[model samples]
Target: MAGKSKSLKWFGKAVTAKMEQAQILGVNQTMAASAAEAKQNHTWQNRTGTLEGSIDIAEYAKAEADGVHGTWGARDIAYARIHELGGVIKPKRAKALAIPDPKKAGGVILVQSVTIPARPYLRPAADTQYPKLASRIRKAFEKASKKK
Candidate 1:
């Protein structure tokens, strides 16, 4: 009976270690999958590739008592929010916004504001990948338990 307790303790430690590793793997895989989905599935064309390049894991996963947590998105991009959620674009420091118009003389047009439609990238990516996370972690945990 005493030997069984010791064995259980060893198994507990092994399970904890394996769970931590699974957490790390899940976080990394989710981040990568989300980023790729956002980049590849978007319909909008990227000229500078700034927004696309900015999409990444903003906060890496940290193991917590409950589980692991992290964040992934386009960081340090001013237009990222506008592109994602979309809204009206108005001139900030000028009278009217100068927009490129090939048909115009100077290939530009001045307007009061332009309405942008919502083209969510991050949210959709997250939704697609979130469901798989649990399965991944559970599989890892099961594999660890099967080992000596």
Candidate 2:
């Protein structure tokens, strides 16, 4: 099928740009398997990994392959190794799921502002990990790197 026209080109730039942005935002990845599979497949949400909306698997994998993230030093690796084999990567390379926009708070909060606490989504720092402090800091790297 021919690609849909951007509102017949009559809607102009603003509308067209908004529509494009929406298109990307709506692009969901389901299982971390295929590009085709990623489309509209939001099953990843139930897992502890990055949000299905925030990242597609390719991007996540590339981030690690290129070493785009800030750092994952000894402590980070040790803490992560503690988790189950594959599960270690989850918290080690995580990102905040979309939080709710304050003005719009009804259904699932798809967007959120950074809060003082390490809100997970905000990628907040690790001030006190008494029981699991080191691990929390590592998770922060995973979450923060999602921004890059």
Candidate 3:
């Protein structure tokens, strides 16, 4: 986990990790954002034999333009700086809110649910489900159902 926490080195010491992430990886902040985008969606040397589809090079180009972060932790402070520019900042100066309500509940995050559409990139499989995503859920459900 040393490798992982290394990436987290840049993460905020202020609020929740996620809020910290948003605080950092906003649009237009390339250096800060590249890590999050790399984690979210990225591509690399494609060696697949089946040469049959298009590439979302535009997305890759945009994302890669920011540059690949070597470690996830190191990108955190940069991400937070980028988050401030976008106006969707996760307030850092405030105290932590572990307890319920009264004092901690102040401002809000982005209310508008913006939908970032997903497009296929680096087609590795013949069927196109992301290989790294949640695959075992359906299998678990089926396995559990047989006992009931």
Of 1 and 3, the candidate ranking higher by TM-score:
1
Worst 10 residues of 2 by lDDT: 121-130
How much does candidate 3 score in TM-score? 0.14
The true-versus-predicted C-alpha distance at residue 32 of model 2, in Å, is 8.2
Clashing pairs in 2: 29-38, 30-41, 96-121, 99-111, 100-111, 118-124, 129-133
lDDT string, candidate 2, 1-148, tens digits: 4886555446466544443333232221111223323323322224543232333333321123332322211132242222212221222233544555667756445322333221131111111112343344445444543553
Q: Mind giving the per-residue lDDT tens digits that candidate 1 earns over 6-30?
A: 3333557766788998877788788
- TM-score ranking, best first: 1, 2, 3
| Each prediction's whole-model lDDT (CA) | 0.86, 0.31, 0.31
Write the number of the candidate with greater lDDT, choosing between 1 and 3. 1
TM-score winner among the candidates?
1
Please write out the lDDT profile of model 3 over residues 1-148, one tens digit for every residue.
Answer: 5556433455244334333233233222332243344333434333441221221112221223344222221222343222222333333555432234454577444322333233332222212332322233334334444553
Residue 44, candidate 3: C-alpha displacement in angstroms: 17
TM-score, per-candidate, Cα-based = 0.80, 0.18, 0.14
* Candidate no. 1 TM-score: 0.80
Candidate 3 Cα misplacement greater than 4 A, ranges? 1-132
